[model samples]
Target chain A: MSLSISYDSSFDGFLSVVFETYRQRLDVGDIVPERPYDSDVTPSVDLFMQPFHVETNADSASRLRRAVVNMAGEDVLNLLETAFRSEERGVEMKILAYLRVLFSKSDPGFARNPTSSEMLPLFLLARAVRHEAGGMLGMVRFNKAPDGSYIAEIEPKYDILEMIVGHFRGRFPNGRWAIVDVKRCYGAFYDGRHTEILDLPDTDTLSRSIAEKAPPDEFTRMWKSYYDTMAIKERLNPRLLRRCLPVRYWKHLHERQQNLAGPASRPTA
Target chain B: MNLQEKLNILGDAAKYDVSCSSSGSSRGAPKGGLGSGCSAGICHTWSADGRCISLLKVLFSNACKYDCAYCINRRSNDIPRATFTPRELIDLTLEFYRRNYIEGLFLSSAVVGSPDATMEKLVYVAKELRTVHRFGGYIHLKAIPGASPRLLYEAGLYADRSSVNVEIPSDRQLQYLAPEKNYESIFRPMNFLAERKLEYSAGKRSRYTPKFLPAGQSTQMIVGASGESDLQILRLSAGFYHQQRMKRVYFSGYIPVNADKRLPALTTKPPLLREHRLYQADWLMRFYHFGHEEILDESNPNLDPDLDPKAMWALRHPEFFPIDLQTADYEMILRVPGIGVKSAQLIVSGRRFCKIRLEQLKKMGVVLKRAKYFIFNPDVPANLRRLYPEMLRPLLIARPKPAQLDFFSQLQAPSLPAPAQLSIAV
Candidate 1:
């Protein structure tokens, strides 16, 4: 009989599932995240495939981690972690299939091949997550609160709030800043010395309140001026602008709030 | 003028400088500092023209002494001009930076007084940002030609990248367009920065040795201004890349903002395709190990408007094609028309595990439409042996539609807007 395995939707929990599956010789019909893990836009769940819960084992997780590191290189292990963190539906099983492919091989060079069906899906998934995270690194615009703290709200496609925190932390080592993932309602708050991932109140309300508190500053006016004047009128390309930056990101990007399609292209309504 | 007016005027003037890349330096925030440079660079947004807006690109000033015919802020033109005090520039940068509106500052200036005086003001901002404010963000300072080597050295100390735009391709053309500028002034600062970067990185490091030009130097050249051929531009770009630590060589398609006897007709379209082709050739030279001579020679003085430079080169030398993907080296695979750097690297590593099938080749990011004719496998027809250059040329070349001339616009989707708000009846 085929078995369905479920874990607590953490990296450690996923690793624990990898260990438990190998030890029990579970014929994995499906592997799943316990807490309603939804993909980017759609809320999807298969009614036929329900998973029985498996307790997360730290010892099991660590042993598998060491084995994967010893067997394939750290790069392979990193690829797996990045893939799992992609938070896409059916990702857990895709990662499992990839791990099966890796553990089946003796030579680490076999893991380098990305053309296989097992490996390619995981690579595409990891790249999607990393690509979104990279965009967030640039796209997050912090609005200074009246309290002298920086607060920014983002609604990323994936759960990448934790992924991009390192960049902001490094960029502003001495300033207090908070980046909140509005969709997930959690944030990484940096206090100049230490960073804490805190569950916050409804971010929509928080962001709206912050906007009311601090009006646009002089520098923001300066930035808007700089942004507007930078475009050469002769080469006005609204078509190219939409391609580089997808429109969904415009909802959160403060500068794109007004008629940012520019006066030339704004007559479409 | 107020700070707002200066920012708008100077920002508009500096828009044409190009080179807004904030990559290649991992300048982390120091203890008690405000920001760090992103190694891969974060483009905050793209401008209306589809250019990346990574830095707060603005001129420190636009009050010019030289009368360059191509420039908007030339001494000959009577545009409203403005210059920023060092304090004002610093304040503007820090505030915008803290709010994450920009990655860092890209400060270029029209020569305010002499080149040395202008360069000193630029250097003063960098030094103050690093030493006084403890700012650790990316700074790209335009090394004004004819600035003293000492000032350029100090500018290198604090800035991640220092670049000097050799505006015109050849010296004679430069003399015709920008008479006050010459080859010596442009090359002098470029040579100094390259040598200094080499000096800093060559030996064992002491604790006190500061990083000099961590991102190295870059240069820009205007295309189609003096009617220089693609051959001339590529050769000059190749020369700069060969001679110095040129991280990037930017190509600006000339927009005729001024009328001069030596310049092209005002009605002539800016040679956008030629500028783009030059960049593609530059990319091939840097990444694909393509020599400049291989790209352009005595016969073809221009890049083909229909086919890309790589495809053109492939058609010119048909002997290289029908490459056996299984046996060819990475460099040889890269030379194939459809395969890019990513696919080439993938092919080399992937063939180790299993034979790459036709289906798997598409999965590996190969553009099957373009790559099918070049690669040899069981799936690609054996009858292609009779395929000659002339027939293949029409098949491979994408005949340019007006929008298709820009590769980006070919894939561009119309902007998605949220449902429009209902206008209430008055």
Candidate 2:
């Protein structure tokens, strides 16, 4: 039979198709673009999936490959693989856009214009992901899964699992831990022996972690004391603080200062 | 005065000077040092409205003996005045730093007491933060005009970056607005520090080099407050960069904090757009190979609010348009209206690999809408160049008005990732 095509209609859908195309070695027809869409299907001829363009795929995928080269270089394909692991779709387009501009004027072409292009965009994106990951990285309040694996749940605007793993891998390379992007449901991990991606636990199950036993080390009380003393009452800019560290991220943040850990789990740590 | 009262008066009085920057530094903590410098870039976390707030910027004291008309902290004003002791200021900085609140300190002050005494107090803060506290964090101290050279040198040793304010755009304005200060008091120390920094870097004197402000010196002018035009500011900034060995010339749009008859009462807010344009032109001069005299002149003192400096320059010098990218010198590529330093470099480099097609240049992030009128690459169709002027006029005329987009975008993230991998997924 002729190759069968499925429409996933999301970033993961695009990634799933990409993965499937690589796996099946299929001569994929049309991939939907982020912009406008037009379709002309001729059943008699080879099947034509929806015709679309990726910002990267346009100009023979120059933007995409250039971005991959810029970000991951010889190993840029690895960044592409990690990017695909992201549950979101348009993110890849923006990622590719960001990468292409970054690579254009580095050493090979360091002509001038230090403040021009990619600098602003790259800064905005990296900081957005870094901010989310750093917040979760510092304040996740992990607990032991039945498998003895350390697990923490997070909901972030950007694909930050790779970012989180990068930091955690450095800090806890020997430990078994998994940070689940609870909203997207799929999570990545390093269990001391191997690294893999797996479906995350259901919300109901993660909620039960409160009643479950806690790790012996628990929360560091000194860290909480340090956080409380850091704010200068004289220089406190709650308006500025709220503006920088949005209230959305506050849900995942642990105010160990007040001995509060989980949401509605009360004033108890 | 007590620490709290001092902080209130000094911080409030110093807010309008507008020259505390944490850019172009890279020093890390020294051995036995408590802090490190990350000058390669400082984290300027801007507010939603786009005001950068990473430096613990404050004044040592605002009780100035000099009566500069443009200054709110002038001795003639009846505002509250206070001073920070070395110990109290150092304590505040350490406490704020441990909480991850600020990256460095931007300490400036009006000339309080004698110039020697004021400069000594400022030096003491930096000295304590460095020698006693072992703090290695970035420190930007302002060098007071007419201060003793020894005090200026002492301030330089403990501070990573320092500046002498050239408040007025020109000497004529200096006489008009700030009569107490003159070019000799300001330029003398600046010239000495510049020479000293050169001497230190050359390793001529090993023991007493004293770092001498490793990030280099910067000066600021109050744009629009004085009657100086944009051309005047651009020319001065260019001169400072080239001749003075100054790292940056920060442009502070004149905001009338106090109603003074000597200072021009702005019918509108200090010309922020003009300040923004001056900054863009400054970038071009520093990195884009544009000359000060070449960019502006007596004919046009201010930049066109409707068009960017590059575009306006292009319209002025239309004869320079349609430069063939393949044969154009690197400098000429930088002059093209739509092209920037980055794009110009790309055009030159990409030509090494293959003929640069219009399509290819677009992929390299060329804003063809403007560049098409100015650049003529061999790979581009001849018809594109022949009709360049006619087809390009609309694009130039239809240029989108400058917007608040850049400021808002910066606020969304605290730091930027490398350009190539900046995915929206960030």
Candidate 3:
């Protein structure tokens, strides 16, 4: 007798697929995959693959949603976010396997230790993503982008493009905005209507792109003037400033507007 | 001044202000805007001293026009000076934020021009950071004394927090030392800002209540820099706490960075231990339900420098000791010398389940050395009752000195000229 297996790409899809596997009880030796692949199904294995096509208006999606609630408790579903963020595919599978065991056991451990076994993989992934998100939180220099929306460019260490955008969305809830992760060739766009993640051309090579067709406003001048005027004379602590704000992030700040707009007064490097 | 030079001077000049406590502000990053507020920003580093360096705590420019005698950057001091454009400071803040270096900006300046002029500059920096940069990060701007109320109010709209350092602990001390700054100059704006914050909060408007320093206004009083008794200083602190609604009364033990004849020579290192004791007293008053009068009365206005106020109180009020653990109220337990806030809560919670024995208290994480002599119950072993006193003193005495006061350790023995004499600022 051959054992069969199936797969689903998303967590929700996977839950639905798993539910079908148990409910249909098609055969003792057959399996189905949520995502289709160009592989020959072994005659002995008896495997089947299906794309997780959520019928846009289908109430069946709610059944899949219910399966998610049953298999992984709402809390586990939340914890699985980190696993989904894991760039490593193996970790994601391990997380899924762990979730299966949890659902199968219906153990209190799923509820008791949410951040531990159930959520640790996702936490590790969120931790990595948070670094870039945090850096973007600190460094994304906002300038007036074309069409009056605010735009910032960042080079984050993780694929936290969505998290970064989400943080900014709260900070400037009213503004139309976009933050492109220079390294990952992706960005999140928040129009007044909705926020969407988008992939972009790998524009990392362009080092000195100007804001497209936007004039320097009065606030910029006042900001420059204010910066020029506020530092004290008797107590200069460059060492302290360097320690606090490393020079690495000075490239995009609006204070650099003067240096960027004018001819280079001195050698930066 | 050049940007680099300004960054150096202003940043150094601004190091002494200890008012920035980042824990209160929990706002995250904005849409299309960069940076979120973290309790632990780079400049926001909390030292063993427990001081938070969350902001670019720097002076706009340290060139002073007023001759405040206690000030190291007094107008007459022949010190190297530098100034930054607001743009540079904000750039530095953004860069630091990006690099996880600083939480926000803590911009103070010596009176370079008239008070209005100096305040206008501070206001401009805050305004630029908020409106131009759309920066929602924490900002603590210093409200220069004698600045117009309008400027002060405008400054609040842009910054999260603001303060005017009271300098000396008392008006008399202020008169003797910082003649250019007086109680009215400082308190007027403080009072106005307090009212404004109240008004804004009461209006039930936007969640962005435009906090006129949500961390609340804090004032630095130069400890050991003035002749005011600890009692006098604490009274002033208490008054500020009650009337001005000051969030913190920072005690900066004067370090005597400059020399002057009118100032008193130090008998010992600027009373750092004394300053530390005052901070402990402050903490007790704030958290331990200690009343200002209860900690210090007319007979002994100053707390004993050798022991923490709570310990000293316990040693003096011995009648309250050997409190019955099983019968004591949580508040009474908290008042015991050995019991801290956490221990008191534990005792309250744990006692509800069963009769608590002395050994069980230790297992449940009670501070037995201090609490042992103060608490008694049927479960306490007979040997434990006799042995507890020995345990108490050794534990209390062995407590690690507060790190900030360790600056006084150099004055260990009187034989070595009592360290360098320090001139009192007030």
Candidate 4:
């Protein structure tokens, strides 16, 4: 008989479901986020099978965390964290299926096997998330605010704000900075001491504030001029530029923006 | 002149140098510093040509004293010239760093008055950045040729990396193309920095000893400018890697920037494909454990532009294959055409649990089409006996579309796997 398990939409909630599955020795058919069965039943689900709602108790979540770490290793926890941050649908279920294989193994080192069917999806998803986060470390551009603070905004595919904050914090320890995820409506603010996530104001309010407190006109103008002058005229390849810096990201870039009046013209000798 | 104008003239002059990486150092921010260095370098942006813009690469001054034929900023070239004061450079770097526009500065300069005077000016900018600004960001200074050893050593203490360009590969060509420069002016400083790095690391003089050239030194050799063969260039690069402990050896395909008689004619395009092959061959030597002789020997001086160096090496040594996936060592497994370092490790790790099958190899990131003939396993059919190297060469070489379709149909498209997808265009 197949069993369906549902839980709150979170990493801890998924771990809670895993703990309950082991405790009851239930044969898990599918692990999904808690939703009204009649309205949101997936086509893949059997018509007869009913899912049992699992409460997200902190005790069970911690217990499952310890069990997985003890059985597999510390690396599995990192893999799960990265996979959980991925935007791919059904990543929760994939992680559960991967852990089920790890729990079945005598050594539990099977979680590290990238070629295994159960672990491959989780590994690929984790790699994708990590790759995006790494790319953002370079592509993220900040502008100086009037208050002597730095501010930048990003629209990333994955939830990578928390993953990349530590890098900026380490690099800019003395300065106050804010990196907002406009799509997610949240921002990570570092106050020269610690970083914390805060709900960002609405777009209208944020844009006005940023416009009012922007850096001197000279900095932006000079930067755009440098970007234009740096490209070699003989080796111009727009295809390669688009490949590296996708058009989607050009919205927030200072150099890619259009219609900025400035005195930063090419110097004539 | 204003900063924007200075930036244009200097940035244009610096574009051809081609070492934009800010990697190999992991210095953290100081007590009240504004920036830190990441070990895995970050590229702030990519130029239109797809080259990374990691550092704010700019020349300190573009008023040249030497007329190198391949250089755009040669003394005879009619180009706008500019120079940046030490204060202006430091302020620009800090402001850019604060805005996260660049990782750090890649400061080079043309000969201003003398090599020593130019070297002193470059060192002053770095010194003020570290002392006055407390900047911990990555700094790569260009060590001027013929500079005093004292200036080079002082520059090393402040800069994370330093480089001196050996524009021409050989001394004879160096004399022919750039009559004012020779190999001794370049190699002397490189040898000095390499020796000083050894002494600093070995002496362990202080508990908090500062690193001298922490990212080590690198040199760029202009390819296709001189008439030197690929074999000679690769041999020289290998010697640098082994003896000098150089961090990187950059290959800049010669761009015909001037109408000099010594340079290759303007009709020829830059040998970018040859430069790409050299980089691939360099990677093989560095990471894949292949020697320079193994990659390009006296027998074959130039690399096959159609195939990668690894595939070329594998095609020549047919006797080494078909290697067994289950039992072959890591080094042997790495020699397979399509298997990279990551996939080779995955195969070794996966086999510990169970014998890796062909499908598992594919999932583990191995490209099976190129590796199938080279590797042997239980899943491979008995009729698929290893053929002679020459017989297999034609199959691996990428053909045009119409011919490729005919070849695919003749080989039974559904039954046999397709060839490896060529990642780099020749």
Clashing pairs in 1: none
Q: Write candidate 3's Cα lDDT for B264-337 as tens digits.
A: 66333555678789898898878888878888889987787556788777766766776786688777887877
RMSD list, candidates in order: 8.3, 14.2, 10.9, 8.3
Candidate 3 residue spans exceeding 4 A from truth: A1-269, B37-43, B46-51, B203-210, B266-268, B324-327, B354-365, B382-395, B399-426
Off by over 4 Å in 2: A1-269, B1-8, B31-34, B203-210, B266-268, B354-364, B377-395, B398-426
Regions of model 1 farther than 4 Å from truth: A1-7, A19-27, A34-51, A55-59, A104-109, A209-215, A259-269, B399-426
Candidate 4 Cα lDDT to native: 0.84
Better of 1 and 2 by TM-score: 1
The C-alpha local distance difference test score for the whole of candidate 2 amounts to 0.63
Model 1 in CAPRI terms: which quality? Answer: medium
Error of 4 at A93 (Å): 1.5
DockQ, all candidates in order: 0.60, 0.04, 0.07, 0.56
Model 1 chain B: ten consecutive residues of lowest lDDT: B417-426
DockQ of 4: 0.56
TM-score of chain A, every prediction, order shown: 0.84, 0.52, 0.54, 0.79
Q: Model 4, stretches more than 4 Å misplaced?
A: A1-8, A23-55, A106-109, A201-217, A259-269, B204-207, B383-385, B401-426
Error of 2 at A54 (Å): 24
Worst 10 residues of 3 chain B by lDDT: B41-50
Ten contiguous residues minimizing lDDT sum, candidate 3 chain A: A49-58
